[model samples]
Target: MPAQPDYTRRYTVEEYFALEEASDIRHEYYHGEIFPLDGPDGPEAKAGGTKRHNRLVQNCVVALRLALRGKGCDIFSENVRLAINEADHYNYPDVVVTCSPADRQDPRIVRYPSVIVEVLSASTEAHDRGWKFQQYQALPSLQHYVLVSQRRRLIEWYSRSDSGTWILASVRELDEAVTLSALDISLPVADLYENVETGPEEGPVLLRLPD
Candidate 1:
């Protein structure tokens, strides 16, 4: 008989961080439920094409850093923590930009971010567009949420309007340029997917994160 795998029981936000191996995998705590973070599996999972996906994310990071020079806004990749609330939920997006001074000193976690970006993979597409989007919208300082696709060169920009509504804007194809009004910067889609290879029919698509 095969031995059964032992799953770690549910843990509170405080208990989740008390362990030494907490960094190994991302965990989400929702209403006292601790769930392992997982992306899509099967075909959607394979669509990522690791090298291409990673390159896309890296290119954006470099461009963003250069654009924000001397602006007092710090940008971070997935390793940085974003505390969603006091109870439990904490997340790490592909990129987070914070202009708030308080977040500058605390290198470990950021409470206020002006903009957040996620490079979409098949496995995480739904969550990113749905549940995760809801969580991010709750942050008072989150002015913009951007979703970049791995399959094709597409960008979706969600900006908060004066009416407290998030408006959707999209840029498709490598030739199109995208402007992030929140950051006061613009870039061509080609720069985002630089050095990435894709099939003729396989191009990135950007969609609104669900409300």
Candidate 2:
């Protein structure tokens, strides 16, 4: 891994919050640095999402919406920001599910999300599976962290176990379903890829551990 820029000009959390409110584009704040989230720049811009990625997000939203109806959980997309902790880490997940009544108090940010989803692209996959995943684990309320691949028909489910360890499960079969134990709902893999072109499973399967 290469070294990241120092970002000499760091901003305070309050300053970053103000910048986020005034900017037209979205930005993610971590520690003391603010990074843009959109345009042909920034981390997510490296391997910009394809048409399939967008469709998958929509499918997930629809599936999760119907399944979670009247369950006292509100679903949000990338439009909403997630605050992982007090000092650092604020992100915009592709899909967010919050059930805590406390989260309703803040409209600008979600403090506690039961489930957070990220649609992976070639550029963002590494950060999603590595750094971002590590940081997201800090949230006590996050029971499920889902990663959907746009390159292939793959879904990586990270569920928090009773012992507080994150267990990884890979779902690849198109006919199979992804069970979100935290939400008590299952989403069919086929439905998520509806009308989307997911090429052959070329690369190694995600989180393929020994049986």
Candidate 3:
């Protein structure tokens, strides 16, 4: 195994931006710290998406595009940076939908996002559900946060209510659809898992006893 990479160093937002400009690796910045958004550290380490993860993300973006066409909304996938708060936090969501004119004009990080989607993996599921979602709650423009499962046909949906309460919803059945009242559109659950491969079985583990 390769030695673990170091990330204890802190950085200013300017420095983070400069690093991003100079390096090919993508990092998420939060409170003067950066976190890599790639696979595990080693020669075999690849980019951050499995076959299922990438397909689901692509399906989501395509669905949103059809629903929001000619509505002045833009959908970004994988590469665009989103500002959870201006300088304190930033992340690259799997899919981001923005209808704000200000966000459409911004060349760098998007300040206003209407919806954020994250395709869950073994490595990122906890962070996506915990601290990442917590930080995303602070964004005033965020109306919905969607989490799609990679190994199963399930989606965890969070939407803000009229009284500023966050409501939890789930779409687990193929016949069911996720009703996004914020976007005024319903995304069919089947569309997301269409013709995609998933559910890799775990292999048996063998224990080495006191060798």
Candidate 4:
């Protein structure tokens, strides 16, 4: 979903909660600022994606949920808020998986997440790969972060190592799959784009951990 800065007054955590309670739209809160995720204030409503976008997201969520069923890990997609106190933020990830007992008890905010998947669009690409991913790294329980592309059948998989470093890898070919060692499962690049339509593919992406 597209996150646009709300130029209004800064809000406390309490006030932000109140705003969310009274409003039907979903907004992300960060450091007393509210970023509306939907509505006219937001040029393209991200909380709700295009039909093509929705299909991609559903494919990811359904696959993860089916794989983790009865294993105690819960899979959630869209609208579920993840609270990052380390960053003073509350934002909704497109897909979130958690096995934390503490998260199981909480209904509103997820403080711990094992895996996070985001289907990227032009507007959200930079933010998702930059600030949002940085904030997510603050969650100690997070082991894998996946970025699904709408322009092509690709997934960028970032996994944390035992030595506490993150390694960046990706699968963009149809027959390729990325293994999530922490989850003990492999997701095919083709599987994620199943039944989904996309625009023209972007130029090839070459990524490595920044120095």
- C-alpha RMSD values across all candidates: 5.0, 6.2, 6.1, 5.3
Candidate 1 structure quality by residue, lDDT tens digits, 33-141: 5544433322234454667666877988987887889888999987777888867677778899899999977757889999899887765676787788889999999
Q: Can you give the TM-score per candidate against the true fold?
A: 0.82, 0.87, 0.87, 0.87
Of the two candidates 2 and 3, the one with more favorable TM-score, higher being better, is 2
Residue-wise lDDT of candidate 2 within 122-179, one digit each (tens)? 6667778888888899999999999998888888889999899999998999889889
Better of 1 and 2 by TM-score: 2
Q: TM-score of model 1 relative to the true fold?
A: 0.82
Candidate-wise lDDT, in order: 0.73, 0.80, 0.78, 0.78
Q: lDDT order of candidates, best first?
A: 2, 3, 4, 1
Question: Stretches of candidate 1 above 4 Å error?
Answer: 1-8, 20-23, 38-48, 199-211
Better of 1 and 4 by lDDT: 4
Off by over 4 Å in 3: 1-6, 42-49, 200-211
| Poorest stretch of ten by lDDT in candidate 2 | 202-211
Winner of 2 and 3 under lDDT: 2
**188: Cα error in model 1, Å:** 2.1
**Candidate 2 colliding pairs:** none
Q: Which residue pairs come into collision in candidate 4?
A: 1-46
